[model samples]
Target chain A: MRGAAQSLKYLLLAAALAYPLMPFRDVYVLHVLVLIMVYMVLAMGLNILPGFCGLLDLGFVGFYGIGAYTAGLLTIHYNMSFWLIVPLAVLNGALFGVLLGAPTLRLVGDYFAIVTFGFSELVVLFLTNEIWLTRGPLGIPGIAPISLDVTWLATLLGVDERWRYAFRGEVPYYYLAMVMVALVFLVMTRVEDSRLGRAWLAIREDPMAAASCGVNLFAYKVIAFAVSTGIGALAGAFLARWTLFISPDMFKFWESFLVLCMVVLGGLGNIRGALVGSAILIALGEVLRVALPKLGLPAETRFLAYGLIMVVIMRFRPHGLFTQVAESTMQSSLIKDLRARIAARRTA
Target chain B: MLEQQLVNGFTLGLIYALIAVGYTMVYGVIELINFAHGEIYMLGAFLTLSFISMGLPLPLAVLLAMLAAAAIGVLLDIIAYRPLREAPRLAALITAIGMSIFLQNLAMIIWGSRPMPFPKQALPAFFSEPALTFSDVTISWMQIIIYAVALLLMVGLNLIITRTRVGTAMRALAQNQTAASLMGINVNRVISFTFALGSAMGAMAGIMVSMYYNTMYPTMGYLAGVKAFAAAVLGGIGSVPGAMLGGVVLGIAETLGAGYVSSPYRDGVAYAVMILVIIFRPSGLLGRAVTEKA
Candidate 1:
């Protein structure tokens, strides 16, 4: 059964990879898939907090807005390459993360949540009021699409034509978003097995006990905040480039709540659950958007459904669809090898 | 001009205090943020509108609406929050947010998404007229009514908390739930009463604001709730008197900040104050220090 389940997973992944190239591919469907990927990255980023560190961060979208506006402003003002803008945006996000986290991390659970919320609202206020920088309520438009400038290689080969390939269609963005999701997933799974991840888990389980065990709780939490917000910014950078227009409304508090909902619905502390949660909720939102109008209700009322899903899930499945956290660490080859060696020794 | 701002700020401050008291009292007893409290306030306005349209007098409509708001609050505690009492705090908080969204959207679907004017026909003819004029400052009759109603409800609330048996039980529960229950305080009943009282005060605030502004919408609660929660935090969570003082201070600051500083960043003032208070003085001005429990 396990072998079959593993095969099914790989088969689905293969199909997903090939779907965009298929003759029957729909533009609308491709757009939704890409949108889902953006949220997937966000869910993984947010999973680091409530899932791993047991800190409920309510202002995660603040970092997302920061990253997006950074990318948008840079592209419009300097016409910088996406490659250069990405690192800059991520660093900017991490900087803000540390700045906000250092002073506020000392607060416990509920207090910490409220402060994060206040910070996000302030972010929105800044975005809306700073007309000189963010373009205020009108939003920044005409951000250049990401392009591959491989002209350097062509010049080395003495080619006549330029080798620039600017993204013009959804197909290129679809693949790029998939690559982004994969990279984020890889980093999350790897970190979950690292010492840093374990330190976070210890902090979440018991701060006092973890402190007695010599773990620097404050330092680890700040690190988690930096990493999490950095990833959130990365996703935001992708969003700005993909949509080609960035607005303050796009990063409202509701967006943070929606992403948090995705993380919780998938199960806190479960990385794969985050991916599943994003896919499910985003797909559900699309369906509601289309079906609500047919049912004589406005599409915005879809939040009502999202809210119901959260309450029902919290009541019936609080741990989410999956229960085991750090499940990847136990399945590592090294751990499996140790198990085998121990069994062999006992048998001898 | 400063005096005018002060008078306007004072009226706004009184409403915030009424709402802030609800947040503080609930937090004191249950340690939950009760995000849906703002939705209750919105519902109060809508319910009053509905009652008034049904041919009920203005006073009767307001009274019925507050009662309904109180019942909804009790039901909210029973249905959504009661089961999560022993669960993790994160779960309860998420559920509270979910309920808030659900209630807000439900109100939208019922009332339509447009802003509705509070029935002007139901209001007294003189509410829009100025009642007092001193130098350059003017106080409207609506402002006077708001002051009177807010003061009355707050005083009534204070009497309940200080002089009643249930009030003592609530304080006992806030200090230590297990001990209070051990003393046969009927923990859940006091909690329900607390929710009922707070929701009624919040309802009155909503009603007055809708009357004052002559408009209300489904999303109005989101901003008000955040500002009031900020007020609650500024007063120090779990402290009623502290919440009142914090609300007044925040309202005056916000009004004066809007008047003198950038009007575009008026809403930002509450958020900035909340974050600063939480970071620098987590205990707030009137509350005890908050330390993480083992």
Candidate 2:
């Protein structure tokens, strides 16, 4: 029965993947799908930090901006290869994550949040004002698109001449983005069940108790930060290659809030939640962007609707749509265990 | 020129300080960043415009704006914040951000996105005229009135906080919610009252800046709100006086940076200073160091 159910799930997944590439698929819809994939990559990264680790970071877009800018600069100035810039961007993100997280990890709760906010604001401000480096507010234009560099392999495999040239079309890029998204999604699921993830959840549940039980709180927290930022950086780099222009304005703190909203709205600490969350939010954005103008509503209504959605969701479902079960169990266990332990200690 | 910039900075900083106080106080009690506070300030400004345009006296308009904002603050807590008080702090934070976005876009819808010039003629002539003229630094009566009103309110707040029974209860609640409740303090009432007071101050700051600058807009709250929150953190998250000092410091720093370095970099300077302060002195200027209880 379990085998049959698992195969059923795989069949559904296969159908979902195949539907997008059907011959009748619209290019605009395809574009939206790719964008959703990009956001899924980002939200998956964020799933590790605030979802599992319980550290609320408001500066996520800062790391994203850094990755995009690094890619843009290297492509613009040094003419670096896309493959090379991807690793470089990831390493840069990890370095910056450590640099930022090392000192601020000790801050508890809201202060940590504010500091992260300040850091994002500072990054955007610097990016906007430093004309010499970032070209200031005008934004960097004519960014190079990614090349597959797979032509040699195709020719070696003796494919037909028509099928063996350099890659082209948004369709290929969509698959490329999907591959990365799948890789990130796989890594996130694995991490959620890994010992490192357990360590993170342990620190989140009770720092002092976790510490007494031999959890290296700062070390694990910092690692979460680095890994999370690295994933975001990877998304940003890939996204920059897809788009031909990059700008300081594109990386506003609002992007961070948007992704964070997805993580929470989907379900904090759930891997599957990240995928569901990003899809709904990104689709909502795309629909509103297209629909509001048709309905003669103001462009600003798009954002107003976003705000209303959040309020309504929080009012109706504070634990988030995807978090109905595990949330209660997790909370009850932690609080109940603590209270029980204290009671037993007093009785003893 | 330097003196003039300093004056400008103080005026800006005082307004930010008022908003910061709202952030600091609410944070002290509930530990949510209260992202909606800036929007409260924006509402206060817009409410003042509505009331004054309806032929109410300026003083009455300001008072009504404050009261309405205070009520809104209370409502915000009761609706968005109160239920999530015992839930994870992250839930509260997200709700606050949501509320802020809702309020901002609501403002934009209610009032068009364009900048509206405040009706300077509705004020007495004295308010429009110069209060005192110095070399290249003439201070207007409006500036003086703003300063005087802010000072008066701050002093009044200090007295209420330090001397009144309500203030004592508030401080106790801030220290320990359960302990204060155990001691017979009504935690709910204290939290509600704190929100009312903080939001009142923020509304007044919004009104004053609107009149002082002679312009208002829905989006004004975004940057001002961010700066004010930064001020609160820079001064120390939960410290009231620290909000004031942080506000003034940020104001002067931005003004001077704009005057000397580059005009566009003013906002950057404030954030840079904020990050440095958070990095170097997480305790803030006057705040006591926080130790993790867990």
Candidate 3:
């Protein structure tokens, strides 16, 4: 069963990688897939707070907005490459995360959540009102798409033509988004098994006990905030270039709630669940957007369904579709070797 | 100009106070921020509009709306929140947010998305007239009505909370739920009653605001709810009086800030205050210190 499941997973991945190259690939489907990947990154980033750390952050979209605006403004003003802009955006997001988290992490429970919500709202307000900076409500448009300028490498290799690849359609973004999702997923899973990850789990399960166990809750929480917000910014940077436009309204409170719903739906603390949740919810949203109008309901009422899904899930399956946390810890080669040693000792 | 802003701020503050009490009461009891409380206030306005249009007088319409809002609040608790009483606080909080979005969109569906004028024909002519005028401050009859109604309801709420057996049970529950349940206090019933009381006050505030502005919309609850929660947090999350005080302060600060600092960022003021207050003094002005437990 394990081998079959593993094979099926690889099969799905192989299919995804090949789909863009396939002749029958549709632009609309490709677009939706890329969008799903963007949200997948967001959900995974957000999952760190409520899922692993037991901290409900309602204002995560603030970081996403900051990252996008950082990328958007830097690209427009300085005419910088996406590669350099990503690091700058990520740094800006982590800086804001620390600035916000340092003082606010001491707030317990709902207070922390509300502060995050307020911070996000303020971010939107700033983006909307700071006309001199963010262009206010008009939003930045015509952002340059992600380009691969490897002319230096080409020069080193003695190539004649300048090596520059500009992304035109959704295909490049789809693959780029895939790479981003994979990278974030890898980081999250690795963190989920590391000492820092265990400390977070400790903090989540029992803060006082964790404190007694010599885990510095505040430092770890700040690290978690920086990492989570940094990933959120990474997604935002990708979005700014891919979408080619971003407005303050795009980062409203509703987007934060939507992403939170995705995190909860996929089962909190489970990285794979975040991916699945994003795909399902985004796909469901697309379906409802088209389907609702035919049924004489406004497309906006699809949120009614999203809201209902959350309520139902909370009442019925609060642990989400997946109930395990750190499921990969047991599957690590070190754990496998330990298991073998224990089995041999028992037989002896 | 300042006096006028103060009066305006005071009126707005009272309405916020009304909503804040609901959030504070629910939080005191369940330790969950009842995000749907704001929707109840929104429903209050919509229901009053619906009732007035159906030929009921304004007074009767407002009364009926409050009762209906109270009932809905109770149902919201029973249906959405009660099942997760023993679950983690996050579950209940998410459910509250879910219910909030559900009801807001449900309102949008029921009443079209556009802002509707509170039935003008249903209101008394005197409401729009000046009840008192002095210097640059002219208090409209509607403002006077808002003042009287909010004051009376808050006073009555204080009485219910301080001078009643149910109030004592509620206090007990806030202190410790398991102990209160063990001591024969019906936990769910008190929670429902708290919701009812808070929802009714919130509904009345909604009606008054819609009347003051002469318009109501579905999404009004989202921002108002946050601000009122801010008020509650400002006063102290679990204290009733704290919520009241917080509401007025926040309202005045908001109006004054809008008037003096910047008008376009009017909504940002409340958020800023809430964040500042939470960071500097999470205990708020009138409540106990919020410890990091559970």
Candidate 4:
């Protein structure tokens, strides 16, 4: 039954991916979907650290900015290929994650959040003031887009570029993003099911007991930070490619907060919940941006509305819409079933 | 030249210490960081500016601003915090962040995003003028007023905490919440009073900051709040004198860093100091190490 359910889930995901390629799709809808995927990727990365590890990182965007800038500079200035620069960006982000997490992970609770907040602001300030590299506020422009010569592959398959328009336009990127998201989801699922994920939960629930049980709290936390930040950098690279422009404005403290909201709203540490959360938030932002102008609402009033919505959400659903429960017991039940199956096989 | 930097750093440090006191006191008592306190500081500036714009005298305006800020602080506790007293710490933390964002956006809606120029003419002519100068170092009368006001406020706070019965109750609550409650102390009232006191101090800091900079913007409190938070942590989050010490140290570090190193790196220097302090001395300079009860 479990195997069948898992297969059904994957099948549904595949169907959803293929649906975007269908004709008659509105360009604006495609655009919103692409953005939703982007945020989903970013929020998932953040979830590993803050949601799974229970580290309140108010400056998660620092890693995102680092990744975006890394890809932007390498491609724009050094004229490196997009494929070549992506890995470097992720590595750069992970390196900084280690640098930040190494010293600060020792501090727990609100102190950790404060340090991360400072780190995020420092990154923005650096990007703003250091005109020599970042070009300050003017920002980097004309970033090359990702292009692939799939005409030969198409010819082999007897398909024309016109039919491939969907792929070239938004469909391919959507699938690519989906693939990355799926891969992250798988890795996170495996990690969360493993002893390491349990260690994180143990630390989150009761650090003292976890410590008594021989969990190396600092080591696991740094690992989670490095992994999450590395993935955030990957998302940044994708964002640079998608927007085809890189600027300090793209990565700010508010961006981090938005990702946090997505995680909290969806249900921390729950992948499906995060996807739903990102979709809802990005949709709300887009709708507000478009609808408010038509409704004759002042531009600033939208921000006020956004703030009020956040306060309301926080006030009512502090645990988020989807509560993250301990999954270990469920895993144990599955393990017991598997063991029983093996014993029955031996008896038969 | 270094002396000027030192003086400037000390002045900035005092202002940070003033704000840090509220953070440390609240954290010491309830373990909540009160993220909205920074917004209260911003409100203090806005309230002061509003009162002065309404043709109130400068001193009277300042007093009114402080009182308004204190009242808001008390109101915040009553509305947002008091109900969440028994909830998880993370819940309260989220609410505080939410409140901070709400207050900031509210301010933006009420006052335009553009900065407002603080009226220098509202003060006495002599107070508005530069009072002292040395070779390449000019000290304004306003700076003197800021220093005097901040020092007096800190001293008064110290006296209130040490000598007064209310101060004794506050200390008792900080040490142990349940015990304090059992002793018939109105824990809710004490907490509200803490917020009010802290808000008043933050308001004073905001006013002095506007005078020092000669302008105020909606987002000014964000950075100042972060710096003040760093100061509070550096002094040990729950220690008053420690906050003062941390603020001065951070201020000096920031100013001297801008003077000697690149000005662009001043903020980095301050944060670096905070990171180093947290890494090496997690308890802060004056803070007592707390062990979690099982």
Q: After superposition, which runs of candidate 1 have C-alpha atoms over 4 Å from their true positions?
A: A156-161, A324-348
Residue-wise C-alpha lDDT for candidate 4, range A1-348, written one tens digit per residue: 767867987898777777786787777888788889888888888888667777788888999999988988887888776677878998999999999999889776777887887787788888888899989988888877776545778788888763223225677787777877878777877877788877887777677889899999899898889988998899888888777777787787778878887887876667667777888988988878888668655354454554555556656776567653322223656644764686699699
Q: What is the C-alpha lDDT of each candidate?
A: 0.92, 0.84, 0.92, 0.81
Docking category for candidate 1?
A: medium
- Fnat: each model in turn: 0.74, 0.57, 0.76, 0.33
lDDT of 3 by residue, A134-253 (tens): 999999998999999999998899987799999999999999999999999988888887888878888887889899999999999999999999999999999999999999999998
Q: Distance from true position, residue B215, model 3, in Å?
A: 0.9
Which structure among the candidates has the greatest DockQ? Answer: 3
For candidate 2, lDDT tens digit of each residue in A1-348? Answer: 767857986997786578667988777887888889899999989878888888888899888988899898998998888889999999898889899999988878776777778888888988998999999999889887877566666688887453323335578778888899889877876776667877888887788888899999999999999998898899889878887688888889789988888887777787667788899988888888789778665566677776766776766776578764333223335544764697699699
Provide the interface RMSD of candidate 4 in angstroms, 1 decimal place: 2.6
- Clash counts for all predictions: 0, 0, 0, 0
Judged by whole-model lDDT over C-alpha atoms, candidate 1 comes out at 0.92
For model 3, residues B1-294, the per-residue Cα lDDT tens digits are 999999999999999999999999999998889999999999999999898889898889889999999999999999999898888888999999999999999998999789999887888889999989997799999998888988898899899999999999999999999999999999999999999999999999999999999999999999899999999999999999999999999999999999999998999999999999999999999999877555
What are the TM-scores, per candidate, against the unseen true structure?
0.97, 0.92, 0.96, 0.89
DockQ of 4: 0.42
